[model samples]
Target: MYKDDGFDLVFSYTFPKCDLDGSYQAVQENSTHKICVDKEGSVLTAVDKIENKTLADAMDCNCLRANLIITSVEKPTCEVNGNYSPIQCRRGTCRCVDNNGNQVCKSSVCEVAEIDRDTLKC
Candidate 1:
C-alpha cells in the first residue's frame, strides 16, 4: 500500500471499492485490486462488514481483494499457554509478546503489535 498526502493508494485492500461481498474477479484492464494475503487471516472488528472477492490465476495465486483495516493489539491479563500473555490478533498478522520479552504469537513480523487507542494495528 502506498500512502501519499494522507490518501492511501492500496493495491486492492482498501474498502468498499475493493470489497466485493463474496467472490469476484478483477477486469485487470480496469480493475484496481490485486492479490494481497492468502493465509487464513481475520479482519479487524472495524472492517468486518466490508466484503471482498478473489480473482484466480492472476499475478499471484494468493491474491484476493478485501478491505482490511488494521486493528490494535489487546493485552491479555490471564495465564494462557503457560504465563500471563497478551492477546494476539487472530488475523495471523500480529501477535502479542509478553511483558518480559517472550514471543507469544507464532507468526514473524506479523506478531509485532502496536496499540492505537482501542484498536491494535500490526
Candidate 2:
C-alpha cells in the first residue's frame, strides 16, 4: 500500500516491492517523487491513489518524486510551508539555514552537543 505523504510516496512491504528487510527503490523517471519500485524493478508504488484493474506488467506513478534518493543521508529540516527550518543540523554541528537550507546569518555553527541551542539561532 502507498500514500501521498505530501513530500513523497510511502509504502508497506510485502513480497514484490521488498522482502523482510528492505524494499526496492529507484530514481524517478523525471526525478520528482520519492517512492519505491519492485524488487524486480517492474512495478512502482504511486504516491496518489491509482486503479489497479489487474496485475500490471509495468506502470509508473510520481508521488514520491524527490531530488535525493540516497536513503542513508540526512535531509535538512523544513517547515510546513516547505521552507528550510531556521536551524539545521549536521553530524557535528548545527547552524542557521535559509529557506533553501543554505547557511545564513553570518556565523551560527553550534556544536551538536552544545547545551545552549540558542547559539544556533540565525
**Top model by lDDT, which number?**
2
What tens digits encode model 1's per-residue C-alpha lDDT throughout 1-122?
23555775657653422325543322121243333232332321111112322222223221122212223353333221112234433343345545432455565443543342124332
- Report the lDDT tens digits of candidate 2 across residue range 1-122: 23455556434433334445564544223223333444445534433213332212132222222313427567665432223456766675677655445667554353333355566546
Error of 2 at 26 (Å): 21
Off by over 4 Å in 2: 1-71, 105-114
Q: TM-scores of the models, in the given order?
A: 0.16, 0.36
Q: Candidate 1: lDDT of 85?
A: 32
In candidate 1, residue 33 scores what lDDT?
A: 35
Which stretches in model 1 have alpha-carbon errors above 4 Å? 1-73, 80-82, 90-92, 99-122
